[model samples]
Target chain A: AQSVTQLDSQVPVFEEAPVELRCNYSSSVSVYLFWYVQYPNQGLQLLLKYLSGSTLVKGINGFEAEFNKSQTSFHLRKPSVHISDTAEYFCAVSDFLCGGTASKLTFGTGTRLQVTL
Target chain B: SAVISQKPSRDICQRGTSLTIQCQVDSQVTMMFWYRQQPGQSLTLIATANQGSEATYESGFVIDKFPISRPNLTFSTLTVSNMSPEDSSIYLCSASGPGGYTFGSGTRLTVV
Candidate 1:
């Protein structure tokens, strides 16, 4: 079983300021990490994923996340944030045991990012 | 990634009634999942919509309350039966593809 823990419940930042959302996980086996963003009343959008190879993965909308194997962490970071970036961010993990058939994702409690101008 | 679509973006229903939510993906997907998001909460997996077989429900969910059907690769539906005010939530469907998973816009169900 895999579990994700997002450190912060809310993060408020001024526009153009850098922000980092912390995430940690506990899994006995190797797992895949993902970050998703949800706008108000909207579906989740994939921000980025760490499958293999790259520890630092770049994603759309100028967002990125680094996977730390030893720390069991995958934290999302952006050099600068915009008002449009204000949303609920979720950290998820999927264990590789199910042959990916049971690709059930365990998500952390979301962190609401509020970008103020 | 696949482009997923869900029907009835928002619906208001009376208590004890049932509502069927639809999910369609542009391409054939190997796996599809249904999830529920309560007010101000994280998503919880409802079931796995397996093609040509019964949906594997999660621990707290049941087949009778939330029935799912996956006749083919690109389409699936979940019917919330005998719904109550507690059943009101955002139902989302996600499909797994080459890159990763893609989610539908979600169906907001409000039970009165």
Candidate 2:
């Protein structure tokens, strides 16, 4: 089984400022990590994912995340945030098992990023 | 990547009533899932809709309350049965593809 944790419930940042959203996870087996963004009254959008190979993964909207094995963390970061970046972010994990299992994902509680002007 | 179309986008239902949300994927997907996002809460997996079989539900959820059907690989439906005020939430459906999963717009259910 896999579980995800997003400690910060909300993060407030100014426009064009740098921001980072923390995420941690625990799993007995290897897993895949993902970051999703949800706008107000909308479904989640895929931002980035960490499957294998590189630990530092980049996604759309100038967002990136680094997967750290020792710390068990996959923190999302953006050098410069915009007002439109204000949304709820979620960190999720899915057990990939030995071969591959398009299995279910366990999501974090979510971090609401409030990017203001 | 698979594109999904889910509906009804939003609905207002009375207590004890039921509402069915549908998802249509552009391409066939290997796995399909249903999720619920409660007010001020995160997404919780309701069940995994299996093709031509019963859905595998998660803990704290049952088939009686949330009936699911996936007649094919590209179409699935989830029905919230015996609704109440507590059942008001956003319901989303997802389909897995090459890299990651794609989500529908989600159905905003308001149970009055």
Candidate 3:
């Protein structure tokens, strides 16, 4: 069974300040990593995904993440964040399943990014 | 990416009442997924619905409690049966697309 762990449950940062949201996953085989953001009372929006190659993956809203295979981490980062970036971010993992067509996602508990003035 | 349309954005239901959530996709998809997000928790996959096959449910979920139907490649529905306050959560539907995975806006269910 695969699982994702987000170390930070809540991260408060001042607007225009850089921020990093840590994410880690545990899987026996190679897995695909992803970041998703959910605004208040809204559904999830995909931020970025790591399928193959390119450890440094860029996402929307100037967000990016590095896929560290050695450390089993895919941490999301931003050089600067806006007030609109305040939302719940989730880290998910999916692996290629042999004889299975569906790419099931296992998600983390989510990190709430609170951008303040 | 495929667009998913979910109905009844939010609903307040009484205990023991059932609620059915519908999802419609703009394009045909091979796999459709249903997930649940409890208050202040992560999303948990409820089941997988494929056309012309029975829905496959995850652990801690059952067909009796969460009956699913995938009538076609672009449409599916999930019914929360015998609902209670514990069933209050946001139900989301998603589909795999050529670009990536897309999710519906989700249905917020509040049982009282």
Candidate 4:
């Protein structure tokens, strides 16, 4: 079983400012990492995923995340944020033993991003 | 990624009543998952619905309380039975493909 932890519960940033959302995980085996964004009353949208062969992964809406094996972390970053970027972000992990099934996603407590103008 | 459609978007039901949520995927998927998100909390896996077999439920969830049916690769349903105020939450369905995992617009259930 894998578990994910999102360090911040809420982050407030000014529009156009850079932002980072920290995430960490604990797993005994190799796992796939993912980031998902959810707008209010909407479904979760995949931002990016770290499967293999790349430490830095870019995602939709100008977002990116890095997978650091030693740190057991996959933190999401954006050079600049917009009001539209304000939403709840979730970090998830899935054990490869599950055959890449999305149902295996172990999500972290969400971090709410608030972008202000 | 697959496109998923879920309904009814939101509903308020009386306590002791049940609600059934449906999900449809545009493409065939091997696995469909049900999730629950309580107020101010992260999403928790409810069950994994696989065609031609019984749904695999996670710990703390049971088939009697949350029955699931996946008759085909593109469709699945989750029924919440014997509902209570504590059962009120956002129910989401998700599917996975080579592209990535895609989630349906969640169904918000409010039990009163």
Report per-prediction Cα RMSD to one decimal.
Answer: 1.5, 1.5, 1.7, 1.6
Residue pairs with colliding backbones in model 4 are none
Error of 1 at B32 (Å): 0.9
Model 3: pairs clashing at backbone N, Cα or C within 3 Å: none
lDDT string, candidate 4, A33-86, tens digits: 999999877778889999888899999999999999999999999999999998
Lowest summed lDDT across 10 adjacent residues in model 3 chain A is found at A94-103
Q: Is candidate 2 or candidate 4 better by TM-score?
A: 2
Each prediction's TM-score versus the true structure:
0.96, 0.97, 0.96, 0.95
What DockQ do you compute for every candidate structure? Answer: 0.51, 0.57, 0.53, 0.57
Using DockQ, give the best candidate's number: 2
Better structure of 2 and 3 per DockQ: 2
lDDT string for model 1 (B1-112, tens) is 6798899899999999999999989988868999999999999999988898899999999999999999999999999999999998999998876566779999999999
lDDT of 4 by residue, B39-105 (tens): 8789999998999999999999999999999999999999999999999999999887775677899
Report the Cα lDDT for residue B71, model 2.
Answer: 93
Candidate 1 chain A weakest ten by summed lDDT: A95-104
Number of the candidate with higher TM-score, 1 or 4: 1
Off by over 4 Å in 4: A97-103
Model 2 CA lDDT for position A26:
98
* Candidate 4's iRMSD: 2.8
Identify the runs in model 2 with alpha carbons over 4 angstroms from their true place: A97-101
Superior by TM-score: candidate 2 or candidate 3: 2
Candidates 2 and 3 compared by lDDT, better number: 2
TM-score of 2: 0.97
Q: lDDT of candidate 1 vs native? A: 0.91
